[model samples]
Target: MTHPPSAHDAPWWRHAVIYQVYPRSFADATGDGVGDLPGITSRLPYLAGLGVDAVWISPFYRSPMADAGYDVADYRDVDPVFGTLEDADALLQRAHDLGIRVIVDLVPNHTSDEHAWFEQALAAAPGSAERERYVFRDGRGDGSEPPNNWKSIFGGIAWTRVIEPDGTPGQWYLHLFDSKQPDLNWRNPEVVEEFHDILRFWLDRGVDGFRVDVAHSLVKDAALPDWEARAVMAGADDEPVVHGDLGPMWDQEEVHEIYRGWREVLDSYNPEGDPQRDRILCAEAWLPTQERTMAYVRPDEMHQAFNFHYLQAPWRAADQQRIVETSLEAAEAVGAPTTWVLSNHDVVRHASRLGLPVGQPRPNGIAAGDPQPNAVLGLRRARAATAMMLALPGSAYLYNGEELGLPDHTALPAHVRADPAFHRTQGEETGRDGCRVPMPWVAGEPSFGFGAPDDVDTWLPQPLLYGSLSADRQEGVAGSTLELYRTLLRLRREHDLGVGGLEWLTALEGMPLPEGVVAFTNAREDGPVVTVLTNFGEVPVVLPEGREVLVASGRLHRDGDGRRTLHQDCTVWLG
Candidate 1:
């Protein structure tokens, strides 16, 4: 499964503008109140027009609806809620036709208890081959004692007992997530073989690649030691301990074998030798520095690991620039490509994260005790964020509805929320469902056509930005946010800044940024490149030097000092 040296020379993941879509909430072709593969196909052209190179559809595989679709019942089949295999095939064909690559979410860490493999493991006698499918051990002081001092990623003990038909206390199995999702025993030869075959199945079906869920969790600390690395258990707010890193043994000469072997499978699919016909492996590694993150992207491993520094970066202009510069320097130091994500299904929106108000909050999204965002300021800030996202180096991840300035609004009742970790932990840390709301394509209509075009009531009932911000309403508006996004994307494609080939120059400051302005440049091997200056302060600020002004949010004009001054909350590019 090897591609030609020339065709596979450059990594496709390097320059792509990737769009992440929660398929079930994207669009519903069957009017079944959920988005499906057919729905995705119908929307393919829209994504293509937006200029994204790849689409990462989150877990549409067969699942039990626990943790949304992360708990897989069958890795090979598309969940009926998301349509059948035929629908997926149609989507892949349509996207490829539009020149958009497709990548599906792969959760190899664990499978649903309902899966045949797990069920078999529960039924088998202790120490049997079937029992070995998962980490099944006796309770209490027996070999089971959880194998370590680990706590579940969801909170509480990581071990739970399984029962046989005869009421015997079957051995307990390890589950870093839900009690129903038993951890696969990577220590077992059979488990690794199972996943390798799963990889081949999709590659053969023509998927461009995969976003490996918990890529580092495929294997755990073989020693199964007690709590290590503090208590990273169950995310922030500190729950109990669970899951461990894939150690030297897991990174074992064997893990590389998995990726190298998988690459072979991907190249085999590109029989015609298309230059861009290849697989992309993205790992969700949120390491502190670029060097740590790049390890996942080097040659044979993940093509792109998650970059979280920007998301965690302070709103202060200098801080944000430093994060980007540090990351760029680190990647270059190791010669690895990076990926960028502004919003995802897990975190709060940029506007919310920045504490800005997001256009009058709906009564539904405002939790009983939460403060409502300053609606107007929120939208303005998000638009500005969009500008920054488009201009960044490497692949840009656009979550659904972000193009339309959509505000996060899923207001889950304390009881109905489904995220396992959120419930298991004490902060009642709102899990992802808050961000995976239905895409409101129609405005003001019943249920906003998110559920069914004809019905107003949807599983996720909130006002659809139809008349105000719906696709139908903003499709042709020249200056609408969606249009701005489209324009920005088109402009991004016209420059190598969106691509990965250019050298990125650090905006080293010899002096503090002039009161309200943030300035930086993208250096190119060909010549001096564009200098991007942005003003977020309350007053207009002037650059100390003069250059050709390319684009401006406020007025792009020269100052008395022969420098360019931009209005507050505006941007200017020197070409």
Candidate 2:
């Protein structure tokens, strides 16, 4: 028998399956061809049906859309393009009524250059109090070059030289990302106070939590330093190695202090109140190691941090096992639960990323000139990988459209690309537009039913083949990726797999398994033991004798000797 979720016992967030909703691409209810708060509110019933415990909405704040909503122009208001403040309240209320919590993005590291404070700083004289809210420093040479040699994550120099009101060259401002996004000076008390107020604004309106964007990047090293050669050449043009000694820009020690303060603010919401209603905070931190990642989720700090290392691990049994072990160990040390994620709006979709060679660094975007991804192989592996992730003893995050097994649209026309990386790299790096295409909802409809009316044009064009992968096409279809996800979620909750203890099972009794297979058992105190087996090799492996099969990612073959066989890139849950 399955027990109802009780937060007073373990809290909803500890083992919740949170679905990430990229507001622009999730669903467009208005005829405007853009997703809005009302659009998301209308879809709460769907998410509730999907069995997700919460919804983590991406940034929908007022912005210039320079970095696709990461550059915030205003913190307290919703973007007019997405919807108004009233719509946000409605989304929150509807989600709560459906027993799903809501977590909105909180981007504190930077703000859009068009923001009132940024505009005032530009008009004010150098070294003025207005400029102190942001990182402003004098150039190294004749004040023409940048102060330091730091490079922006997008491309080009991290510093942008500012022209004085008197028409003379002045100090430069720092922007870790697009130039339009000026990095805030976290050292400033006013900046800290402003974010605190912003957090309360949403918390007061009944938001469940905040997904802190670039959580590790809030505090920079006091002394700016140049990037070392090894660090500069770490990844592709668009992929910056923010992990491992990225000096003066990311993973600074002071960032922990900031989150500790934010933790106090979150705790204030549930003072002597029900633990079930306690507001939570999750970090989008990209630390170097699992141990380092756990620092953000210490008992007194944030509740969870994204497991990027697990997502980037190669599709090998050993690699996956090592990451899982380290992640669980580190999270356990802090008394916090681990968060497993496959894909998000920023990176190439997992379907395409998994199809590439195992060890090579994956690019953020794939261009038309690039080699094509093997969609069939990618989808098979993705389905198996997600099954394994959901059975693990922690929370799992599902990006929008992953349930439909959507691959990145690599053939997108160059003219429609909007990612700043594409513009900065001059098309050398296609950017992340391929993964951010509007999600398909209905088959054989214009824009694939991403928006209302056949004539409405989505913000980003949908691929011609999207109709086949539409949610409408996959719904209720056996063996479909969507159905597989729904089944796995149902089983996960029924067996308490999300909060159960995990034990690696290499061989049953005396039977030895294949070399490239991963097997583990999700053993709950009271529920039946669910053994998960995944095959990464070419040849099919025989399933252990006498074990009853519960579910499988692909078709299974039965041997005459009464043994069940699992095909390559397939996963199964057995009792």
Best-matching candidate per TM-score:
2
Model 2 Cα lDDT, one tens digit per residue, 61-110: 99999988999999999999899999999999899999999999999989
State in Å the error of residue 29, model 2.
Answer: 1.6
lDDT per residue for candidate 1 within 240-292, as digits (tens), equals 22343422212323444566655666666777866576677887754434665
How far does residue 70 in candidate 2 sit from its true spot (Å)?
A: 0.6
What CA root-mean-square deviation does each model show from the true structure?
5.4, 2.9
What TM-score, computed on C-alpha atoms, does each candidate reach? 0.86, 0.95
- Find the candidate with the highest lDDT and give its number: 2
Ten-residue region with minimum lDDT total, candidate 1: 1-10
Residue 54 alpha-carbon offset, candidate 1, angstroms = 1.3
lDDT of each: 0.67, 0.86
Q: Report the CA-based lDDT of candidate 1 relative to the real structure.
A: 0.67
